[model samples]
Target: MAHALIRRTLHAAAAAVVAATGLVAAGATTATPARAAVTCGVLFDDFSYASASDPALAQRGWHIRTSAGGPGVPGATWSAGNVSFPTVDGQTVARLQATTNGTGAGTTHAEMSLPDRRFFEGTYFARIKFADTPVSGNDGDLVNQTFYTISPLRYAMDPIYSELDFSEYLPNGGWGATGPTNFQTTWYTYQPDPWVQDRQYSSQSRSIAGWRDVMATVSGGEVRYYIDGQLVGTHGGKFYPRQNMSIDFNQWFIDLTGHSGGTSVWHENVDYVFHAKKQVLTPAQATARVNAFRAAGTRHTDNVTADNSCTPAETPPPAGGTTRIASNWNNKCIDVPNWNFADRQRVHVWDCTDGTNQKWQFVDGTVRTENNKCLDVADAATHDGAAVQIYTCNGTAAQQFVLSAAGDLVNPQAGKCVDIAEWNPDNGAVLHLWTCVGGANQKWRRA
Candidate 1:
């Protein structure tokens, strides 16, 4: 759950578009060309846990919330006790229960999340059962049942903040809205106090009272959301996630306003979840994959690995601190051939010199020369041996590089190291991409 205030303002333009065009009709699907199979990572969990304390759950990187938190009724307790595994409809399911007695302190929220913020640009799928009425008490609490992914907010309006709300089902409605509305929101960033937010959402108003397939596909800068194989919304631009995020499912009370007196208990159930890293799968294709896994008796599987070894810098280097990027193999500085600053000029290593082309400044994930040309991967290629050159900075992933503490300059998108081609040590040795093997030719440092 992000914040209560964050969902208050829906983008007017998005709302207008939804009103005019309407959501893609149920069972509507787009045909896409078949792609050749590529080696990709994946994660799937049937969530057949014995209890909230199941060691297998923790081993699989799941954390049940026991800490107190916001994004719910203030002072509400978030407890591990609220998360349980039970047999429902002959299937083991993860269940989250939220209860309230008309007071903040008397409310308890439930949440389960993965600790690793490594999911990005993938197809996420979950089968969830959302309840519109409490099992034991009166209904009408402003409860939120959600399946979302989020990265930490380093600061107010952090440009790298990423979050995608696949579904936020409001059975009774909060933030001054009517009941039984489901929202799919894509977030850019937000501020807590004084309440500011940048987000886009599409909503459908109706009773979604049972098990439903909720999926979101992230690729090519856009996030397409589908419910039961029906396209519900598509959002992109700044709202597209810029960093990795943790997958989460939570149920919390928006406020205690709907509570009458007695304790009201609401439940959200999750049958399973799946993620295909860096792959764009349609809802039908994703469902087929899930079925195949189950048919093969696969309980759980996880092969998703970190995209790169380098941790990105939180802030750019100090101003006026440009330095020569010297290759450890020959102590030669990365240089622009013959002082040419033209786009697509191949960058090479030259003897340590006083040339401005050899002086590079680290700025917002890009290495820039004195002539304002960026060190970029030619053709935006991610394959091995892709050429390295100087190009106009366009803020694409090809222009992003992170110099690691271990001295490897890595293109995170390509998961490759900047290497002196073929371990060449002579002046004018060209640069290219290669698997990070920690070789001398792949190591660089500021000189």
Candidate 2:
């Protein structure tokens, strides 16, 4: 499990917003490019009857816990969302449709239970496309809900779990009091405790329509939310442990009650692509992977498929500099020359001349300018064309970093980590964040 930094009330609101968006903001620095070594692990693996029997789930360290409301009782025909084993494309797909209520709409929920007890921090992306709607109430009358869930129970709501709802919709402009398109990314301490909600966590108060890709990451003591390729919000610092959480994809009715009775919502197809790389990633690297996976459709798959090959990246910290920034981040902090806030503001580690840009802080896990802003990947590009820039602080995970025991710096957002440019053993070369492997590029030495 990752260590939780000390909690502070002063930055709670701001940090919560960051936790909601998933992507971290830009800061003063050179945007680290995505290295080939950093790749995905187990991109799409659905454990349904098609791939394996329900019993086999336990053998693979997964359990079919219960549903949201409860187990299917007598007269209740619960559908075990259909699953298809992986093909050459390497994808485990699961499909489920909700039952309609009197209003012709229904809600469905599915979950996956994990076996071992471990604390892991990573990102998840889900692709979704909804079916037709017959505008019962009025025009633009859409009713559907989709969510990515995490449960602590072996089945059902035996023990309540946490949830990251991408889009929760209903007829007549959303389910009763529920908001439209806007989602609630919450954390539940226990079954009794009410879920802590962050409503403004999203970058906008709108719904993601058509085929949309949403990403989320949890690291250290922080949890961040992202949409498409942009950073959104962040939450949870020093609150919960990084436990071994299972992955779940669910679509349910907007109004379980008879608000919009008997309306069935069919999600034609869903693609939840995951890459479990053991290394940390820079925002640029993570965005690149997301875009690539988005373009690749649901057929792409790879975990540990990339070359573990890496190069040295860190330089020894100056004498007496005991402070560790991030294990993969070079301790060198250069002064930001007196430059205007142009479109591109590449940050560099120079002699700690104590300039405005040189000052840095690890706020809620994300690396931030002492001025309280985040270092950003200008224009969200994967190619070398992208430049590193600084922008207003947003608590997306992309800005978060960690210092490993080996003095290596890691970015939980990208899954790929930081690395030294080369083994020149000199200070002039630039330090960049790249795909992670156990290489000198991922190691650092503080003076």
Candidate 3:
């Protein structure tokens, strides 16, 4: 979301001007937009790291962000390319020769387990060809796209985090018949949310011989899965809101503690990957930046600021054309650029312009700066002269501000409307939460 640039003092000055002009307050803005503009791009692929460090593999969207806390191998590790992509029998097979070491679940890696963005309706497609041969003991190692599955160790993590699994069965070695292929799209949470799981399908006829295209599309909160471009199953509400995380891909072996002779089950022949695109890219010129890096085999350029192609901004403009004077007095709007200063210094408002620190968002019930700092009560006591300060955004009643239907900001906790913190008309003054007394201090109008 684009952050709004406006200093707290300027906001107060805007309010004061509204009161001076005798404009009626309208409380909060109505009509929150339903959809958001999304930024789409091509992430990296494994080929990007063919030249550099192993950690550089993460440039492709997968990460090893875990510290393995419990039992298994006690730490996180990335598997090197030991598995070969040779054709076994008449089919191509991809296998990983590495094992995991961590607490409980072997060695684990944290990946971009989920999408960082949310979508109300769109189709996600993945085409994969699997190995016909199932290793002796380790089956169920490879599963489809999952959310909370970012980390291998699942139990201790917060369940509120979401997860999705497509397939998770190992190759069957019994008989000469082809192993059964299974697919699923399920949501998992720490707290049992029954409505999350939607579909699962199993087929013996589906094997590693041919290309299988899997598609997932959501509409009206319902998810539909398509195989080979044909609708196969429908899952409704088994989904969660879209999140901003990266994608993860891994291949590992599992132990056969229960089976005879402990056959090491393995998955092989993994190659040819693609991610669905939401927007059609622009002319070749627009893709030049991406293509340049792609051609360089550089994988990615994370530190954009050093590229010398970026621009810097000057001091941010005042809020709503309202310039605020600074003051150390209490009970006033502090003039913080971006409202990220630790202490809520009182100040007055003035004119508007561009500035890095003027942006703000009223998150939950608290007014927070665009930089993610919070507007806070300097102390616990809710007296008339209580000081206001800037801190991190935490959902607290003290931080919960009541913007009147008329647009005036009110602090019900202090039972007062925000007034000049020190009652100073100078450049800076502390902004504080106070009772709503319907005075000029309590009046504010829209910018």
Each prediction's TM-score versus the true structure: 0.63, 0.44, 0.38
**Candidate 2 lDDT (Cα, whole model)?**
0.40
Candidate 2 weakest lDDT stretch, 10 residues? 1-10
In terms of lDDT, the best-performing candidate is 1
- Candidate 2 differs from the real structure by a C-alpha RMSD in angstroms, to one decimal, of 15.7
RMSD per candidate (Å) reads 18.0, 15.7, 18.5
Clashes (backbone N, CA, C under 3 Å), per candidate, total 0, 78, 84
What local lDDT score does residue 320 receive in model 1, on the 0 to 100 scale? Answer: 61
Which runs in model 1 stand beyond 4 Å of their true positions? 1-40, 308-447
Identify the superior model by TM-score, candidate 1 or candidate 3: 1
What's the TM for model 3? 0.38
What overall lDDT goes with each candidate model? Answer: 0.77, 0.40, 0.35
Count steric clashes of candidate 1: 0
lDDT at residue 51 of model 3 (Cα atoms):
22
User: 1-447, model 3: which lDDT tens digit per residue?
Assistant: 011111111111111111111111123233431111111212223232332234544443233323222111224243443434455445333333433321223443222222222222333434445554444444433322111112121233234334333333234321122344444433423322221222223223355333555445544555555555556566555344232222333333222222333333434333322232232222222133233333434323211011111111111233223222222232223346444365554323433334434334533234556555656676544666676666654434455453444334544344345566444555444466554444454454433
Candidate 1 to truth, TM: 0.63
